[model samples]
Target: MKFALTLVSGLLFNSIAQAGVGTELVADGFERPVWVGAPDSVKGKIWVMEQAGTVWIVDLKTGKKAEEPFLKIVPKVERKGNEQGLLGLAFAPDFAESGRYYVNYNEKGGETQIVRFVTEDGKTTDPDSGETIFQYDQPYANHNGGWLDFGPDGLLYVATGDGGSANDPKNLSQDLGSPLGKLLRLDVTGKEGYKPAEGNAFAGVDGALPEIHAFGLRNPWRCSFDAETGDFWIGDVGQNAWEEINVVKGNKTGGLNFGWRLREGDIKTPGRKGKEIGGKIPENYHAPIYVYAHGSGGTQGLSVTGGYVYRGSAVPDLKGRYIFADYQNPRIWSLREKGGKSTDFQDHTKALQPDGGRISLISSFGEDASGELYITDLTGPVYKIVEK
Candidate 1:
């Protein structure tokens, strides 16, 4: 039986006073999974990334994990304890036809690289077949960035973390010279591998790769595009305080500096302030639509995880809600953005995954062709978000 349209629960369903949320464990029992992807093009396979450098394709129809993997890059990944191994994956726009897909992982020396390839039943190729679309050197481990996604503009977008190690020692996020801690957009349609789209900010610049769309972000963990508006929502994880989520228009300006190591949330960078070198304050920096104080245990297990805007017909109350999660604590939160007033949805979080960690490291949310949403627990499980 096909399970894409069916709703299944993991834990025993506990009906609470909450009106619209449904809870369950759709798929469980696997290894240390990190990221998840289920393109509308692929019918039954729910792709998951294992921290040990392997990809598992789970068939929603059978609820059975594929014995073979869609891709594996163990030989190239560094199995460091906190942050290493295969991290993110994305199927090409023509994946069903071309069978091509992409992944972002930490290589042997711990550098992050975006590699693309073609897949048949369940396997990926090497450097010869899959070229390195982009590569950046990593100073230390931990924040290597998150998933790869194709924006509404049809360009492949990548999110890279600030050069790791406590604060941004390199201040790479603010430096346009470096690609670290930035969001890159590239035209992967034609040309050999990847190229900056024509209208990209630095498209004509001599030295810069046109793909550099926006720079100065500190580990934009998970980002998404609204189906109706095409606006991009970015969840940039904070250092000590303030986890932020910013939404920008489809045709907005690039070169946005998200003030890392310099400014966390709206607060000014300590010591250095006012017109100093590398100390330019973001007077009009795109402020996050929503800001959560890091002090709450909410950010404990709480690295920010991006979720989808509820556009599915299943839940009317959640129709325009922006659902997100904190990785550390695994708590799910929602924000309702309407008429310029962004009201925090506190009722829903208490409703779904109340205890948190029902799914750990809630990496990324998946939407099927029909626009229904699915949540991937970092530890090898997938759940469909249903409304009671």
Candidate 2:
């Protein structure tokens, strides 16, 4: 049942610190916190999402979580499976003014729902205010890709996993008809229900889902946009042999295919080795910018957890470099992409280890209003990236 996690032992477990980079404890005591983010309109506070269906506000200065959750929908959420539950939250780009925000969760009926609501104050929302912007039934429980955010273009972007099960029995990643295993773009800006963003890759195309901007993603656990360049980044978890980091630079994000069940980190997946995509395979599939094989110690890791390009003033040395890590092997590292190549790779694991606690099982990474980065540990603590 815990197949994905049980295979985490393959990453190299080196604890070497690279110097100049570390992490400071921001808050602790969260229950399986899957996400943490700051609304640009809000200052010095962050919202944390617990997998059990509660989003709480935490004061950055005191590390104190509010006595009451900012939002709670536990009874309607289904967490029976290891990967199911309330998994993501994002404040609208204009949240400071409109009081509107969104949440992505698994409803009790086995559908992954993306809902919109309004909060008069920064702290809370009415349980009955939820308006479903989108909902889809998941074929299986495991790989429900649950990350969503507003891209630099101000449109909502969502990630969904292939209808789960080993080797993607349905082959949804390569299918144009199914929404699962794809990056979707939607316009939630109007007064009415949502619409596929005007330029989504498959909009108006025959047979393909209108919201699909890119296809062939297995399970993108975390993704972010670079603050300065607006480049899109993804940490797509691989099936058996590898974990990869993918990117679409300069905001040119439409119609790309991130080879998934067909290929895992540039290699044919063991289960899909002989299968072809009905045409030439390599020409259209976008390869990962960087990929680490599951191996003994060092940079090898299982379950890649993608992070942001450091843009915070607090870590000047890290500026412009992308920070990422592994959930199972638990190491931190950074690299720079220049001229379409990943350079300057450095391991920050030893340096990022919290003085009083450990950064085990990193569920997701966060970016605050100031562009500083934070990491959420499924075990509890949230740590902020900082200069050592």
Best by lDDT: 2
Query: Against the true structure, what is each candidate's TM-score?
Result: 0.86, 0.93
Q: How many angstroms is residue 107 displaced in model 2 relative to the true structure, after the best TM-score fit?
A: 0.6
lDDT of 2 by residue, 183-287 (tens): 999999997579999989888889999999998888888889998999999988887778888889875778888887777876677654775533235446887
Model 2 regions more than 4 Å off:
1-16, 272-283
lDDT of 1 by residue, 1-388 (tens): 0000101112122213357786555577756676666766766567767877787777767777777666666777887746667777777777877777788888888888888777654344443466788888888786677567887777788888887765677677766667788778877886467776767776667766567777768878777788778878887887755677777766363766566756765565444334332355664366566665554353333367777787878777678778877776566767666544356444344566633555656766777655777777766677777877
For model 2, the local distance difference test gives 0.84
lDDT of the candidates, in the order given: 0.68, 0.84
Candidate 1 residues lying further than 4 Å off, grouped into runs, are 1-18, 121-128, 204-209, 251-253, 270-280, 297-302, 339-341, 354-357
